[model samples]
Target: MACAGLVGCASVAVTDDAITQRTAFALGVDRKDLTISNRVDDGTTSRYQVKTRAGRQYNCFVGGSISVLGRTVSEAICTEVGRDGATRPAVAPANCNALLKSAGKC
Candidate 1:
């Protein structure tokens, strides 16, 4: 009863297209040149691993809230992955320094 009320009745689904688009835009690449290596969906949030044709890899996360009326609001974020498995805010060949600076992640 009370627990049910606390749970959301609506489910949010994150599409591959959305993730790919967001990743491509963040890396300043074309969608055709990017490949999605993995995707994980945890209810209202989704995480993806995207790789570029140039061998760059990124980790992308997109989360959103869904209203009872079925309205969804989503936000996406991406970070580059180094060879050591560390995450960074800038990607190579994409002028990401400026992007990271603007996003306050640099």
Candidate 2:
């Protein structure tokens, strides 16, 4: 798993309250109408952005991840505050620019 070392990731799970608060402070998003959760796979070097609908209480994910043996390569949880006073949790894309625009480390 030497390749695993080349790629690394992390994640965090927060309550709806904490997510809302942090998202507001960081992204300036206000409105506890959404939930976000993401996982990162280092194997294929891909990230998945799991986000819930503002009107719904289910998480819908976007993005791609590396796969091996029909399984995920790496898994991580990213916690941060985004705009609108809501916490946005998404797999940080492998792309530098994409990752930078994902969310804050809050």
Candidate 3:
């Protein structure tokens, strides 16, 4: 099946620093305010569960390189995890939404 509606299916490695920073940016929060965990890697992508200081949780999927000599995370998506474990598109700030518009994900 196609990976549409899925996150982190790109053919690139996911970096901790890059993913964390991008996740925070997408959530409109500081890196220090978020706690990322439960990373599961599958060659091309990495999935992580992130919890913010305010108890908001998310499932962030990341892939692609974030280096000067490579493309910087052309595909990074984070979805909000509901209390019952269901996931939905994360609601990002206007600026962050605009930034992620090109990728068609949040």
**Stretches of candidate 1 above 4 Å error?**
1-12, 68-73, 91-104
Q: List the residue pairs that clash in candidate 3.
A: none
Candidate 2: list runs displaced more than 4 Å: 1-13, 39-106
Whole-structure CA lDDT of model 2: 0.36
RMSD of each: 4.4, 12.3, 7.2
TM-score (C-alpha) between model 2 and the true structure: 0.23
Q: What is the overall TM-score of model 1 with all chains considered together?
A: 0.67
lDDT of 1 by residue, 1-106 (tens): 1113333321344567767776677778899999897677666677788888999888888774444555353555778888998877754445547766777666
Cα deviation in Å at residue 50, candidate 3? 0.3
The lDDT per prediction is 0.68, 0.36, 0.71
- Model 3 agreement with the true structure over 58-83: per-residue lDDT tens digits: 88887664344545563457888888
Better of 2 and 3 by lDDT: 3
Top candidate on lDDT is 3
